[model samples]
Target chain A: MKPIIKIQNLSKRYRLGGNGGARYATLRESLSGMMRAPLAILGRKGRASRPELWALKDINLEIMPGEVIGIIGSNGAGKSTLLKVISRVTEPTEGRVELYGRIGSLLEVGTGFHPELTGRENVYLNGAILGMKKEEIERKFNDIVRFAEVERFLDTPIKRYSSGMYVRLAFAVAAHLEPDVLLVDEVLSVGDMAFQKKCLQKISQMRSHSNAILIVSHNMIAVRAICEKVILLSQGQLAAAGRADEIVPLYEKLMLENVKTETVADEREEGMGIIRVKSVRLVNRAGTEARAFDTGESMKVVVEYEARQRAVSVVAYAAIRRPDGFICMGTSTRLEGVVLPPLEGPGVVELEISELLVIPGYYIMDVTFYDENFEFRTYFLGRKQISFQINSSLPSLDDKYGVFYQKHKWNIDDVNVNSPAHR
Target chain B: MGLTSNENVSALEPAVTKQTATITEASPIRHTSYQVPDNPLVVIAPTKSWVALNLGDLLTYRELLYFLIWRDVKVRYKQTALGAAWAIIQPLFTMLIFTLFFGRLAGISSEGIPYPIFAYAGLLPWTFFSNAISNGSSSLIGDSRLITKVYFPRMVIPIAAVGAGLVDFVIAFIILVGLMAYYGIGLSLNILMLPVLVLLLTLLATGVAMWMSALNLKYRDVRYALPFLIQLWMFASPIIYPASLVPERWKWALALNPLTGIIEGFRASLLGYRNFDWKTLTISAVITLIILIYSAYTFRRMEKGFADIV
Candidate 1:
């Protein structure tokens, strides 16, 4: 079988500095520089150094046609660099690659779109970037519009579309393009659940049609569900490969150990400021081994603080940061009906987050103890950013992919109920 | 640290974890991984290439080029206070300035035509070329978000900028014709030379825009210096004064600016005046083509670094 993709030893390097000053140069300066050009080339330190960081080095790889592979790695693992080289978005410093057929890449959403242009206009525009002709775009126009599900807004300028809408539309156009090979980055991480599922199904459909796909994703679940093989990149080189089941665990373990070994927030805020929240372990009413909080479970965020002040009528606030740098939930004792008592030295405060409406995902908590008048406060009262995770089986499993997971029960209706089973 | 459920992806059965199972079977996930080809795949290569004219492939991507041009045109005046009228307003206002300052105040000759008409004529191609060069050159940096992410011809940016100025040029040309009618000047048959001038302006703009666009990707200082450079270039050309007034001895030297000849030729073509100096026009045309070709070569050489350094 003819290998559809190949990468030999590839490298990329860059020179830093030299981005200032005016463009004035007299003929004398020019002549002198021209004269010194040969001498400058011979100077030892004048060397830019193949300064030699190979984004990819000796990375000779071959893949059979129609085989889906997951390129997985931690950040700076050269995954994107490899993708960049393979996609021909950036040329390799060394090595050559040959493709028997046309290739389309979805490395970013709205890659070549003019935001002022309408979706219909951008479809033809972006299609042309993928090397499709006008007739080819027109033939697939309806399919593209239908798949993106922005048919009603097709005439509207894409700038008005939400980032989610942009990705969906862009990905839909890429999917319908029908290139022999597709390179997709973590673009599916956008959009709601149903849309993501639609994309996954569409990708599978593409596979059935014999279009090879390479995906880079941190979502191991998605990788396991779709990828036939997994190659893990570590520090610009292949760390592990061959199987997803084997490689993913090692990757996860590696990440988990990194998480435990380093308190990232502590390191980030070390010199900034430091105050302390003595304790943060939350507890329920029963307190009978309540390891996790359920949706609607009455919970207490126990905060004990040691402030460096008299702390009169002290106020305390807690906030949750979602993994994607979004604020999930936050509230202060002042916002609630609590006027804190004056604090002379140390204090313990129990704030009830009435109904934990958050869904399953990693959440980090930041606490601050302040004076009642909201005077200047130290960072996190010293404890820094503590971490937590939320899980709600019903909403997390069904509703959507955002921070909140509100409790709303549903009644099921079976079309075949009268046909016997449920009846 | 306790979220070990993800461990199922690596270890099959926990019972065999201590035994360290040598996983033989590849992961059953059905993803198709494309090989990165023996030669770099032409996947995200900018649709535009400056290496060779690549006009065949360009013709193939004509719709993209068309839409990009159209997009730039729309975006230019999308929410402007005067909308499409700004096109006419920009060149018309500049012509007024040149007429007042250079013609009226400084006492410059118009080669026997009305000052406004001759100045406007000079401003037409000059504005088109300058605007094209100015905007086209900085276009790559202006849309760094787009350039860094997607793989489209980087040349399209400067090309679009130049293309967008054509709309303004057309609008300004309409005004020029109306002015010509008002001034009672007859159209010379030499107007046949107008198309060639326009093409020359485009090639020159695209070429210089290529250099600026590519350079601007790395050094944004070019953007700041561009307007000043254009101001100096305006004086260097014959936009306000007649090129003939630059002194017969210095005319050959002044013609080196390229736009001087193109602008003079444009003015002479539309107005019933002196037939354009074929020698100066020929010299300017060749120089414009050379600068264009050379800048394009330099731009091509510089373009590969755009994604990385840009």
Candidate 2:
């Protein structure tokens, strides 16, 4: 059988300091640069120049029909660019792609939906924008409306509908687009859980139709659940491509490899250099390194650091941060009026908590060493030195509610006999 | 290491060797030999030279084009209280302003025709052209979400914008017909060329719009500069005054503005009072063709970066 899609030698280059570049220079800068061109050439060694950065380089792949490939990468790794090129949203700077069948891309839902247009009108409009023929939309109109569960308000303008309702209707119309090849981005991240599950179920059903699917998402669990194969990208280059079970773990290992104690600190790893944080490790109550923890369990963090010189009135502190990078809480020995004496060499500080309060998800560790007086000179901070995962104790409690898990007691008291008499 | 299995490595190695591997070695593999020899390949490369559009692909996506046009038309007057009446009201009011300022105040000549009917006839194609240019130039940026997500002929976007303007042109054309009736004018055989004139006007508008829209991706100044450009363009065309106002020597120069002949042609066709200037029409047609071809080429060249920058 013929392959559904093939990519060959794809590459994209972007010029820095120009329009749409990282610096986002305006017309004024360009005009001034033009004026300085002659002088800049005379002083060529010191002149600032727009450099080229390749977003994607030399990508080659073949996807057969019925195959689902998940593209996983860090930010700026060109995962989105790869999908954009495949969908022909952006032309490849140097490569070619051949597609064997009708292709549809759902990069976003409600792309062209107008607030004043009725839901019924928007369904057809959004459907057509997603490459659905008018006849196909007409035939599937009832099913789309049913799936979105907006039948009661189908004729009403969508502006009055809640945001959740808007996304539901948008996803429903997009779901009805039956193309031979589907390219989906992180559109599933929207809507409620039940609606998200419905969309995922619909996507799995779409796989049985012998169509090819390429998905790009930051949600690793969703990718692992749906994709058979995974393509891992690192710095605009293909790092690995294989089965999801094999590649996801390898990718995670590669991502965490920088956490080893042997590496030197560099830029992007924050520190004041008066004292350097050697490592940050999570431990269970039993004092053993814990790869993962369960909610409501006691935990500890060890901050190992080395002082460059003998320093009096020093303190050690650590902050726990959610996966979204906001600090959840901060604790310090100095803040609690417990400061260490003069320190000359390597040392370790252990901060303990009675129970971990974060719900199921990943959390980062940031350790800092500073003077007792909180002076700016001796301040040292390690931002996101390490990360740990938390598992939910009960399957019923999910991460969708919020990040922190609160502890509380629940009870029911019966006042049965007095109720009717009092009334 | 487990995920990077030998089989996976071997599966990925074939592409590298296929170019150099001998036929005998490849034929022995049953799986490789069983499938049809080769799938059609599409190689993407940067534009090295001028390129023409693929009409067959455009034809296949005709339904999408129709849908886009309908969407533009529907969304234009969606929440307005006056709805599509705004279309007629626009040109009507503009003609009134011109009749007041240029006709009564400035004492501009309208050949033998009445000022309102003359201006309205001129305004018909002018309104269509300006609307087409404005909407078409902004279409790509307006639908940046779609452009960055879906694959379709990029030309369909600007084409649909122009197509949507035809609805307004038709709506406003009705009022122009009424004006002609009130002015006691009759349609001549030359009116048969009205469709041809409209087609030329659309081509000119679409061509310029394609160029402007494509450039707008890089320099957003096009968005701000376009309205002022159109205002100046209207003055250059024969809208408020007749083309005969210009001396015979410079009429050729004025014909260089494509809309001059198109608007003059609209008057001659609908009002039946003026003779068609064949030389001016020929010059306009040639210039329109050149602009259309050149803009399509430039548009195609710039389309590659649209998704990246947009």
Candidate 3:
């Protein structure tokens, strides 16, 4: 049997050195670039002067029909560009794709829906965009409406819908597309948990009809659950590809490696410096690979460094960032009016941010080495940002069935209006 | 639709290997094999003039454009007080204003036709042009989500914007014809030119709309300036007065507006105006042709960037 989709020597190169495309290009520059296009096509290697960056390079792939493939990568890994080229959203710099049949894509939730349009109108519009005919859309209209659970609000303008409802209705149209090929990008991050689960089930069911599914995501669990095969991209090249479980750990390791190498500190670790911050790692009580923490549980962050000289009045601080990039909180020993004596030799310092009462989402630890005056001996040093997720075994009283576990207290009591005893 | 995997590709096309590994090597793997394959498909569209559209493909997608147009129409009137009635109301009220200002107040001649009927004829095409231009200017930005996320004919956007306005044009046209009957003006043989004028207006509006829409994607300030430009453009056309009011030499320049011929031709057909000024109408036709070609070319040039920048 032939593969349903075939790609050969696919590559997408984007130039960042040139202005960010915000400014118009000068005629001379444009002409020069056009003139040099032939030389660049000849594949001349750069000699440490003129350079180029390949957003994707030498990507070759084939997918047999009915296969579900997951694309995983860190930021700037050419995952989106690859999908764009396949979906023909953007042309690849150099490549070819042989598509077997009609293509349907949901690169994002609510991709083609107009906000001013009613849910019913946007359904038809978005369905047509996915290559469905009017009669076909009408045939699935009720099923789509039911799946989205927006029958009551179908005639309401989409602008009035919540983001989740907008996503659901838009996704319902895509789910009913019934195309031979489906492309979904990392837009699963948009919808609520139950809807995402519903979407996943639909995708799995859609896959059984010989529909090829290509999913791009940063979420590991979703890929592991749905995709039989996985691909990993690293710095515009194919890094790894295999079964889901195998590729995910490799991608994680690659990300961790990138973090370690790119994490350079402004201040030195030692080298005649009064005090220096070195390495930072998040560890559980047992000191294993752990990012999740429970409320009231002791969590340790080891900030290791070498002391260059005998120092006094040294302080340490850690700032926590929520997954949304907001700084949840930060505190320091200096703020507490306490300073530690200096060490004469190299020493590893560990700061325990114990009893970490925070929400159950990804959080980053930012370590700072400072003097008693809050002047930075070293600012944001030593593995500056390390992420840790909070995992709770049991939810608090208020949100026992919620998506995330949060600590709270509540009480339930029958209200008695006559509690005053008829006074 | 993306199969961005190499191992699967390797399973399909095995790379060439020349060197043989030593027997001690595990699995006796080859020494070296490194080669990058060229893209197999090339764009070889015909360079011939007037590439015949694949009507089959267009027909297959007709339902899409139809749904798109319908969707636009529905969304336009979904929450209105009078709904589709507003479509007729807008042009009627505008015709009244044009009659008050350009007809009754200014004493402008309407080729001896009723002022309401004369203004209605001009307002019909003008509304289409103005509405198409304004909506078309920001159509790409308004549908950035669609452009960035999927692949379709980007032309569908401006085309849909134009098509949806036809709903309003037809509605207002019925009212115009009703007023014509009320004014005791019978239809003339020149009315056969209505379809031709409609085609020209569609092409002309589409052409300019494509240009403005594409440019608006890059420079969003175009979106802000579009309404003001449309209002200014309305005055520049012959909707307020006849083209005969302008001098002959400058009248040549006025024909360059493109809408001059369409509007004057519209009124000339229905009112049976004798001095239809075929020479200026022909010049306007030529100008519209040029604008159409130029706008399509500009739109194609901007098409590649729409998915990225939008």
Candidate 4:
């Protein structure tokens, strides 16, 4: 089968600096620039050789029909640029994209929605902008309104609606668009949880209709859930493409490594001259550094610090956080009433747990150091300082769902069928 | 030392984990090949030619153009106390001012027709032309969000702005009819040429608008310069005065301004005040066509840069 979308040697270059870098330039500035560099102006080039940034470089990809591909990347990784290029929102500096069948792009929800217009009017207007025919919009009008759940406010201008309502209406109009090839860019992270679920369901439904959907999103959970395949991009280049489960973990590990190196460099450069944190590590029972631990395994968090001068009554804190940024556990020496020795050149603080009860998933550890009065006179004021993973080896423990793994047993005492208190 | 005391740690754990699974369970991959109908395939690449007016795309996106025009017309009068009445009020009050200043005070000739109705007829087309150009000049900037987010024939935006002005033109045309009736002016065979004149006026406005709107996306100087340009252009046209008022040598120059013939054509057609000046009308048609073709090419050349700069 022919691919729904095929891109060849795609590249987009943006010139940096000078008036060219600005969105628009005034006539006076342009005139002066031309006068200052007549030869360059005649040549239709910048006065100096302008630096260029390639938003996308030499990208070749083919997406088959009925495939849902997730694009994952850090910020500035050409994800949105790729979508824009594919949708023809912006022309590429080089190369070409061939697309089969009708294409619809939802780079942003409510691309042409007017606040002054009523919700119903905006639906028609936005639908038209998304390439839906007038008859198409009219046919799906009720479905769009019902999905938005703004039936009562259909006649009211969207400016009067709450922000949630506005997003819902916008997304609803976008969701109703039926195209053989659909390109979406982070529009799923809109509205409340239930509405987001509805949108995900809508997207999965689109996938089942034999449409090719390309989604650029930072939400790992959403990408993992709906996409069978994932593409990882880094620095405007295709880094990897594989199955969703495999590529997502690889992307996460790359992100964690990047964070670790950046934080270590930051610590050396900005060490406040009072107390500096040298390293933070997670160790298992084998007395070796580890990033993965099974449920109920022994784990220790060790923090090493260097003090410039004698300081008395220092306090230390450690907190474990889930990938979703929820802090599972937080503890401090001050809260526990522990006193520390003074005049430390170098010292180590360890938090040991006999049983690491965290459920199987990725987690982050944050450490803080301060004076006994809670004044942060120490270095390393950062979040997500270290990240680790958890896995469950026990089948019984894997079935239960929660943040922490708890050991419990169930006892079944059979009540005799023939002797229910002689009832 | 171990810091695992229960008093020291804050466990903000919820008692119940409802586990409302939002992620759909991954089904086995099905290699279902979609049988795409013979829909038109689109190939996107960097423009190779200097001029690429994909006018067919305008036809394909005609519904979008209509919706955009509807949106403009719908939103223009919103929140105004007078609502659509402002459409009639703008040209009506402008005609009053022009009558007071250019007609009575300046003693400008109206070629034998009554000054009020004469000026009203000229103002009708002139108002639509100027508003279309002014609105079209900034239409792309105003829809910058749409430009950057969606793909359509970029020309549709300026065309829609020009199209939306027809609503006001039609509304103001009614007042022209009322003025003509009050002045005892009756329709003539020349009146049949009104649609042709209106078409020329629309073509001229759309051409200039497409050029200015595309330029405005890059320089923004068009925005600051447009209103002033419109005022000068109104004077250049035969709106408040007759084309014959100009010296003979300058009359040719006046004819060079396309509005000269189009405005005069409107008056001659509606009021039957004078024989149709076929030479000036022909000049107007040719110039309108030239501007339309030239501006379409320029707009096409600049189209690719719109989403990036906008």
Q: Model 4: residues >4 Å from true position, as ranges?
A: A17-21, A33-38, A41-48, A263-423, B1-33, B36-40
Q: Whose lDDT is greatest here?
A: 4
Error of 1 at A96 (Å): 1.7
Q: What is the interface RMSD of candidate 3, in Å?
A: 11.1
lDDT string, candidate 2, A247-278, tens digits: 87676555545433323332134766767777
Tell me each candidate's TM-score: 0.74, 0.74, 0.69, 0.77
Chain A only TM-scores, each candidate in turn? 0.63, 0.62, 0.62, 0.66
lDDT of 2 by residue, B1-310 (tens): 1122223334755532342223223232223221222655344556666665776768877888887888889889987899999999999999999999999999999997899999999998999999999999888888887777777778889999999999999999999889878988988899999999999999998899899888776667787899999999999999998999999889877999989888999999998887899889999999999999989888887787777777
Q: Where does candidate 3 clash, by residue pair?
A: A183-B1, A311-A342
Ranking by TM-score: 4, 1, 2, 3
In TM-score terms, candidate 4 sits at 0.77
Highest-scoring model, TM-score: 4
Predicted candidate 4 versus true structure: per-residue lDDT over B6-117, tens digit per residue: 1121132111111112223344443443565554388888998766677899999999999999999999999999999988998999999999998999999888778888
Question: A291-349 in candidate 4: lDDT tens per residue?
Answer: 88887788898888787777666677777775433567878787788777774688888
Candidate 2 docking band: incorrect
**Which model, 2 or 4, shows the larger TM-score?**
4
CAPRI accuracy category, model 4? acceptable
In every candidate, what fraction of the native interface contacts is reproduced? 0.26, 0.44, 0.30, 0.72
